[model samples]
Target: MLQTAVLQWPGRWTKKPRAAAPPQFRDSSQPASLTVKSPKLAVTLEPVQHEDFSSLVVSVATTRDRSAFARLFEHYAPRIKSFLLRQGTDPAQAEDLAQETMMSVWRKAAMFDPAKASAGTWIFTIARNLRIDAIRKARRPEFDPEDPAFVPDAEKPADEVINADQMGCMVREAMAELPDEQALVVRMSFFEDKPHAEIAEQLRLPLGTVKSRLRLAMRRIKEHLGDRA
Candidate 1:
């Protein structure tokens, strides 16, 4: 009786049939239908032309232009930093000195007379004064000019002095090989301790040209002395 009942219920009648899927479905393997493209940007930097301070100082002081002050800051900030560094100041202190120097320049812009001193000389003097003040405030021992005990060690031997003289002569000869303009300014600035403006006036050259000549001379001197020193 059980076999007869199972036969009557067929396997197809017991199973559930799935409904058909909708026809609009698409395959996932294919790429998306749309894409986006961004346009490339072109960057252009305008050439910057710096005004020469030697020429602009009179105008800047007269007009009191903020741009001129900006130019001054740009030029002297690094120089003051370098000056302080040379004096053995730490970086933070040197940065502070530079800031102080710039502040002084801003306040004293009216004092900047191109006729009296070149920009470099004016800036150097500011740094030098600051350095002097710093040294003075340290309260180091004061040297007595008349005290024999405080005098420099007795001069080196005559032979050593002669040798030094010979080396100096050789260095001078090397300096003689420099261009006349360069050598002349170097000698005046270094040996005579004359300001660049005075040197320029004496040489009948533009102050900028005088500075350029002196810089070239110094570079040459440094190159020549490198091995000797």
Candidate 2:
């Protein structure tokens, strides 16, 4: 099974005793909670160290803990597969990509830095890059230079060219003003011509989250343009 393959990975024979668990995180004297809100439910997890799943990654990195890696795989694999399916991948290919994504996670576990991103974000990034590579590979046919669609467009007047450059600069400035998460969704939905559902899946966010981010981004962009005008 792919799950078995993923957990066993390359260093299964290492017999190092599992290290003692890390100290618990706390809010003052109380255990800190991590809330994960999905479309189906909102669950508040008990304060385990690194409730964001960072500790599991650390364990995998430092101890070669198969159980920790297995837990991470179980959490991320389905999400990655669902994300690929929404990006128009066929079922079989999506499954393969998901497996590949997990394998990469296993190989690169030692490189994970929780200070930069959560475990989920890092894993999804790998999935996204692999998807892009697969898409590029599948588009290998050479361009037909003589095809009518390849005909050059009429030259634009100097004034029109200047106006387009100014507009593009303004758009870029507006995008730069956005928070990273909002800017990402905006690029996926508008710049890349992907739908909100696809954006949500790829980002491992809820549908409402994608829509709200788009709405907020548009409003902010409009405000920036208005100020410039």
Candidate 3:
């Protein structure tokens, strides 16, 4: 069954909540920014097409468009529930968590950045995190605050901190030394947090090519960081 209870506006629980006003968009004549990875590693953010799911999320974020939220709820709730069920959650819990996940989407809509992730990626990440949290909570045991072993660890020594910083700089320098194609995929997969398939689609490369580039990049980075790593 579709979980419609959390889809309604707060304090307005009903079988069918009233639809909100349609989302508004800026004039099409104006330039919009959307970040995309170019062959040269240059980035320019083109405007997302209106039919894109990212645009729907943007509508909800910018306008508090209940209609857009409803559409998102309708689309993602079932998928999230199924995802939870596959992870071994009880059906009732799955249904409830699905509703909670959508509610989180509604609340955290403003945090969604299309430049960083596709709508499905961002939404599913939330669902996955909620599931992980549920599992952890269920398995966690009570702990005493006075337990000496529970104390936080001491801060790293100054030398260790300096070494870590130097290592990070070296890693970044190594990344810069990569060929443009390899570097582009590395940034997309690591910095942008995109999956291999999404990176392949965005770059218009074969899946094998993407994997090959990543593998080559990792090998070079490892070679560069040899002793330190």
Candidate 4:
């Protein structure tokens, strides 16, 4: 009976349904570049712009952002260093001054405003004030008016004072006769206590040339004031 049922079975076969592809995956052979062009999948990039000190200062004060303060420090510190250097300060001292200036800026960050002055002008003023203070401190000497060694009780005669004033005038006249550049170097070297090498560096001249120029200037002055001393 079983054999007879098998013999009567249908000749056609039924097909099974296939599973769907995953939502994220694509066919390996297909190009992925075409899929990225879809507007919904595209990424948009914006350009980055740099901010100046005024803008950075406002941002730091208003937003309490440390990065903005850093930007300002980076911009001004080197300029302060150069200023000190041009004033005849050594690199180490100039760097210290620059650091001090930057510290002052950080402390006074709240005082900065775009309308009052530019960052460069503000920092230059701070450096200028510091330099004046330094000069004053250097020039201030302890004075004992009555000290026997330091002060003389008897004043010089009117004639002697007149002679000294005349000598000073003659020296000034002699200096005025010198070529402008040579006179400037000599005056700065003598009156300002600037070393010859420093003067040379400041004026951007060779050290030998500075020495030769100074020597010539002194010789001329001595000739002009012959026997005056």
- Per-residue error at 190 for model 1, in Å? 11
CA lDDT, every prediction?
A: 0.53, 0.59, 0.61, 0.55
Q: Write the per-residue lDDT of candidate 3 for residues 1-229, one digit (tens) a residue.
A: 2211111111111222122121122222454322232233332223323236777788899999999888888778987775555444678888988998999988999999775567777888787677757754644344666798887546865543334234444455566566656655665563322469866765567799889989999988877766333
- Better-scoring candidate (TM-score), 2 or 4: 2
| Rank list by TM-score | 2, 3, 1, 4
Off by over 4 Å in 2: 1-52, 138-229
- Candidate 3: residue 173 Cα off by (Å): 30
TM-score of 2: 0.45
Which residue pairs collide, candidate 2? Answer: none
Query: Which pairs clash (backbone N, Cα, C closer than 3 Å) in model 4?
Result: none
The parts of candidate 4 lying over 4 Å away from their true place are 1-51, 135-229
Candidate 1 C-alpha lDDT tens digits along 125-189 = 77666655664464335567579887664665554333323444344545655654455466455
What value of lDDT does candidate 2 attain over all alpha carbons?
0.59
Give me candidate 4's TM-score against the actual structure: 0.38
TM-scores for all candidates? Answer: 0.39, 0.45, 0.40, 0.38
Predicted structure with the largest lDDT when compared to the true one: 3
Instruction: Give the per-residue Cα lDDT of candidate 2 at 78.
Output: 88
